[model samples]
Target: MKRGWCFLLLWLLTPAWALAAELTGVRSRADAGNVRLVLDLSAPVKYKIFSLKNPYRLVVDIESTHTSKALSMPTTGMVKSVRAGKQQGGDLRVVFDLSSQVTPTSFLLKPQGAAGDRLVLDLGASTTPVKATTRSAGHQPQSKPKPQRSVVTRSVRDQPQRSVVIVIDPGHGGVDPGARGKNGVREKDVVLGISKELARLINKQPGMRAVLTRSDDRFIELSARRRMASKQHADLFLSIHANSFTNSKVRGSAVYALSQKGASSAAARALADKENAADLLGGVDLRGKPDLIKSVLMDLSQNATQESSLALAEKVLNGLSGVNKIHRNHVQTAGFVVLKSTSVPSVLVETAFISNPGEEKVLGSKKGQRKLASAIFKGVQDFVELDMALRLANAPSRPEISYEVRPGDTLSQVAQRYQVSLSRLRSVNSLRGDRLLVGKKLRIPTVAGI
Candidate 1:
């Protein structure tokens, strides 16, 4: 009787001894702008998820969980690959390598019928929805539900528009401590201080959002910095840096835009060469890319982008003149790798010369940083206002009417009938002469008053 009772007690305690959750399988799917990852487990597990930059990645750590074998899942959307491994104390760790930054959310699903305990992760852009899969698990086979809702919510008439996004980058971080001043002030630290102040001021303004490439002391690749701005759909990309010179006497601030041809001056060429060399220290591999590919990439800077960059640079330079000495009266042009963004208007602002003794003191002080930040913020405000005004002016205020020419209709007759000037009608229709072709459609300009 005693032996039978001891055996029953041992059997009852077996489950308590083996309480670790087992990860069974993993699966992933992706839609237009979002990705969904599901993890099947034997029991509910405590887990945490976080994001890491510098070649963006998402990490999932599950406590008191173990996987019998390596876990692998297909990559989709922003995710480039998935990796799983065991951590200290037998915890399961899964990592997702991503091509771009994403907003991540996770939740645990209770067991229901045939479905076991599961964890689901949703990754997507900020403006897109991620709860589509979570809310309708039973309707996975149907495609109509998600698209109809997405279309309706995205319509301009239904929802309010998003604000303009501005990405600010602080140059030189981590092991690569850019030019140091005599007082032991680092360029990276100074620029970060100024960038943070600028971001703070920008956030207080209405209809403007600010994003920093690196909010902390982390090293980010030059190419990845620009990619971040593009992924965020940024309207403006501003890189903040403290300048240095061989002559410690050089003191002033300057602004630069990307130049397709060459540097604007000899000094600008030397500075560009110096800044471009930072890639080597940051561990950027250019060996895989061919010369032809590099040439093609350089040619991607379109005329419209260049013009906008120069306009922004000029405004920023003008603002800097009020706070500090102007190094170059005009906006300088350089082949800066950071300013090579094809779509977003990009500019590099040299806040002040860190090598100069007097300027270094100002760059390192909090009050001076605030002043510099205010100047840059004012410049951005000016640029945004001017850009908005230009867009409004270029946009058609009234609807244009198309009129088909009749057998006896003349250009002046049509203009008179439409209550518009003949010259305005000719210009709107791109007419070279007074003659009008029959059966041809002419666009009539809607003049307020004739």
Candidate 2:
């Protein structure tokens, strides 16, 4: 009689101990452009993550974990399908079968009020090519040919290749030193170093390639940069730059994407105007012509590509948050003329503010450059995984569900209701203004904000 009572008591007490487990830090995202998993735990908790060969399923096991809160599997942003349940002995496990490949950015958030220690995971897009800068001596800078290359090339039937082309634009080259610091660090030099380091890292990754607008100290026109990407059929474009201000106290890195309508932020429009004026300094003809119409259409196409750009920017931003101060919580979008390429997903990363004396010293150092490069590389890796996940999710069929605009549906409010950032809402809807008036309609992209 005593032995039977003791056994029942032990079994009941085991679950209570398991329920007390607290999750500490979580630090893993897709690495090596492959669908990988990373997890940082608070204690020596038993867990396993592995893929099964037969039907391509990944299983994750966690010992002694139970919750009244529902266990939600990763959704179809960067994931195809997911299922979670408790196995025998009351252990927690999750199984995922990807249609293609999936890279997950996962972390654990501690209990706040009602919730217990929770895990958060972000799914990212497929990997594209890394941005590279080419310094070929014989590479010719050509004028726009009379017979323009076809904008759309149908190559779906061709064999898939690993090599991906990327264009890297080092902002403020030549006479344009961009933002200057009293501490003797030039914004142009800082950005160049980071860009070179990033290029080196990207090139090291297999099936990736990068090109630079200006290889040396020479100046390259903004228009020429876009032309170069189009000529090479570049998959992605990234422009590296450093920020500066009158006050040296401001610090942190910022990522910028192209904005089609309203400025990504108040400061973005100013930067765009300054960058667009670079051609004036180089004495390029800006007079009215029929070719300019094509340029306008190209700008519209750039808007469409912002989706990919935002994915890249978010991954990079998430990585940078670990090392440096994040300038903005979310990726910033703006009317950057340099990012106005139709087919390519383009972004401008303000690595740090050069005006700060401490940051200036760090930017000039080799170690700082490498750190920045590594963070950026991680961001790129995350982007690739997420991109692949998205492709796999959408491969089968399009999702259904639409939203008709209601009165007082401000961009911020709609974004909040949908649990997305305001910038994303604007990007998808092509809203010209941040303040939405009554009677406008917008499409909700995802089933839910994953």
Candidate number of the best lDDT: 1
lDDT of 1 by residue, 361-385 (tens): 9999999999999999989976764
Q: Any runs in candidate 1 off by more than 4 Å, and if so which?
A: 1-161, 287-300, 389-450
Question: TM-scores, in order shown?
Answer: 0.51, 0.53
Q: Each model's C-alpha lDDT?
A: 0.74, 0.60
Cα TM-score of candidate 1: 0.51
User: Weakest 10 consecutive residues, lDDT, candidate 2?
Assistant: 148-157
**Backbone clashes per model, in order?**
0, 18
Model 1 worst lDDT window (10 residues):
151-160
Q: What digit string (tens of lDDT, one per residue) describes model 2 on residues 375-429? A: 9878875555334332322333224225667875677766543334567677777
List the candidate 2 regions with Cα displacement exceeding 4 Å.
1-160, 285-304, 389-450
Per-residue lDDT, model 2, residue 144, is 24
RMSD to true structure for each model, in Å: 22.8, 21.9
